[model samples]
Target: MNMLEVFVSSLEEFQPDLVVLSGLHMMEGQTKEMRQKRLLEAVASISDIPMGVPVHLELASMTDPELMSAIIHQQVFPLVNSVGLNEQELLFLTQAASGPHASLASWNGVPDVGVVSDIVFWILKEHGRTPGKASDLTRIHFHTLAYHLLVTVDGYWANQVAAVAAGARVAGTQACATQTIDASRVFLKAPLEFATSKMEEASTVSLNPHEPVSEWHRDGVTFHYTPVLVCKDPLRTVGLGDAISAEGLLYSEIYPH
Candidate 1:
């Protein structure tokens, strides 16, 4: 059996509470057609568990609007419960939302919280309205260097504050892992006040049109936003978003309403 078959079989046997999918860009094949087929099959095989897909778009994928659209709209968006994207991917999606020829000048630099928030909601709205979308996601997650944002219907997940804390802890773990620090140091030494301060800092920045900084209600959804545990000098930059996404999903499962 191929990788897809093996993965599906394992899911059936183990019955995991959550599954995080990534590395679509790493799938190997001589031709694009071959890889696309595998991706579609893999997406089809996942049905039972709550799945999250991070938009870890490679440089090539970022440059190619057509490929990016196909991967998101055709394969990933339709299969996952939640979607995670970093700042760059979020910008690209914003551009795509505008149209094929939309200018990227507005999103070129470091965007403010309000700008990013608007783009995220636009993407979510587009996904919901897209005809023939095979799946409807319950949550939209956006991770940036400084903070993370979660958008979901009010009452869909209990304890939004705790969920953000869990994600921050996971991000802390990633930073520790990069520094070769003992993982135990995180739980033993990190103070709760530090995380709280970060959240406070993130909340100081007002949303566009003067909305609250951290959490707000709009269109039946409550937005949960929190600052990340940032590492000053990091050994690695890759896979950070994946770690954050996994931790958030696992935390929600363990402490669901």
Candidate 2:
């Protein structure tokens, strides 16, 4: 807290619209005592942000169970308005909280859409803002090799389909290091026809190749899903999550004025 006091004290002058925090994993190197102390500071720093300024927490690969537990159980998850994560980070979060689909060690290939939907639904219902909850979380931008999912409360976010497609498009362009996409060099990994919806058993969502974004609603939340154009031979695998999240955020329109 002391180290960042100077920056934390200056939020009013800058008055930024969005705040993204990505390096909490950098604190994992210290001893448990020191790490716990820093986690406290982190909570204080994030909680001090001015009201209505959306904060997005970008998570990375973290293996320490204790550190993961602290983040999930503390004010960190409650304070942030949005979160961006890959499959590994998403699974780690569910595992930490012992939420839905927590028993699987890992996925063999691209995770099933129904399963992913179920877990994402669980996250919002339990931890996110809803009718009675006091938490700030209202959106989650989840990405994987095959597809991207943007799940948010209806009123807080607009432009759902465009935001999701932007994320998918950037995944290919960034991975291939090209501004223009070459069709032959990329392939679709998500199902072209349809995907099962676990939110309601025996139901599925259809994907249109011409317009790939699939949308559905359940339990007062809306879902947007889009297939990714995966690079056949990728030059870079690192930082793709950040690219996807940033692209989606750029297209997303916040409803609040």
Candidate 3:
């Protein structure tokens, strides 16, 4: 059987609450047509369960605007309920979509959170409004060294906050994973007090003092975000985004805050 058949068979057997599609560029397809065909089949097989696609652009795809566009418009935007992008991926998407042209220095230095938020919101809105789209996205996640931002509709505050916390923990675990050789030790620890301090700072300064999590409202959606502990020098970076996206989705489904 082909890749799609295997994926479909697994989906049937597992019946998971959420499905994540990542590293499509790393799949066995030598050509775009083959990859997209498999992607369509996998997406079609998923019925009601929420699907997420993280923009894990490889080096080649990152430089190839055409390939990036096809991946976003043809494969990802149409199928996923939520999409996650790291800092670099977020900047690339914003520039590719002709939304903004801010420098990474600006993002990392002074870090205009409002500008970043606006760009992300615009991307999500555009994707949802696209005509003939296969599915409507319910959430957009932006993970950075400094923080994790979740954009979703109103009344999902609890789920969104839970997702933020889960993502933070996953990120911390990934950092720990880099330091050790054992996979079992990855999720064993995290700095709770550090995360709490950052959260308190973000909530006290950027958002309303009454709310536990930092949030902003725009275009009928609420942005729930929390600061994450950044590894000054991570030993491993691969799959960090995937870890964050997966844990975030899982927690949103299971805990709901």
Candidate 4:
């Protein structure tokens, strides 16, 4: 889109904490499908460091959800350790007595709107053996939602909630603003723990430490990229430089796309 060059060039400049790659709908000349694919490739290819360029696609309508989920599972999640969602956002779509799917069935053509965080609390309360157990059913519903060809607005929120709940956390790992559940935060420890548990239950192959550093080949860009990801700021950069530096720069990338 018009901002791509601006954004990409900025990546070469500010090199901020994390780079999220949404924004393809703004491009004027291409079809939506083409734009999404091009954006996906550019984002995925940004790595010069071993496993450093993990890409995240927001759970948006524009992409093929199954393929996107497959990509996230295969190319991004292992490299990343977190995905955050606001509790209110989840409540907007799902709730105790009904989810968007049920609403659609009832409506036949029109859809009902619900509060995200509010509904999340009710859904968890109703489905779980206990509050803590609710996220499990939420996660199942999410994984299934990702595979659906058509999505209800509620379904979209459900997938996001489920996917993240599947290993997702509250933004910055604090208590849900209204619900009081331990929200997934910006922290790595909780997400890592959740991911490990999910794999164990599903018997899926777990992500291994990324390929060795020396295996990567750089093509003359000066920015340093490392094997693992974590958010970075000026202070963190100083700490990183102390521990790992190449060509006079300390480098780390955040994997949450």
Q: lDDT for every model?
A: 0.56, 0.85, 0.57, 0.27
lDDT, model 4, position 203:
18
TM-scores of the models, in the order given = 0.70, 0.94, 0.69, 0.27
Return the clash pairs for model 2, or none. none
Evaluation by TM-score, superior candidate among 2 and 3: 2
Worst-scoring 10-residue span by lDDT in model 2: 193-202
RMSD of 1: 7.6
The CA lDDT at 147 in model 3 is 70
lDDT of 2 by residue, 212-251 (tens): 8988887788889999999999998889999999999999
Expressed as tens digits, the lDDT of each residue in 1-257 for candidate 4 is 44545565566555554444443323335665775676566545433222333333233222233333333333432322222222222322333223533232222221111122223233334442232431112111111110101111121122222222312122211222322223232222211111111111311122233521111111210110111222221122222211211111112222221
lDDT of 2: 0.85
Among all candidates shown, the one with the greatest TM-score = 2
lDDT of 3 at 6: 64
Candidate 2 residues lying further than 4 Å off, grouped into runs, are 1-4, 193-196, 199-202
- Please list the Cα RMSD from the true structure of every candidate, rounded to 1 decimal place: 7.6, 1.7, 7.4, 18.0
Runs in model 3 deviating more than 4 A are 27-61, 102-111, 129-134, 155-158, 177-212, 254-257
Candidate 4 Cα lDDT to native: 0.27
C-alpha positional error of residue 163 in candidate 4 after TM-score superposition, expressed in Å = 18
Write down the TM-score for model 3: 0.69
lDDT of 3 at 167: 86
Scanning candidate 4 in windows of ten residues, the lowest lDDT window is: 143-152
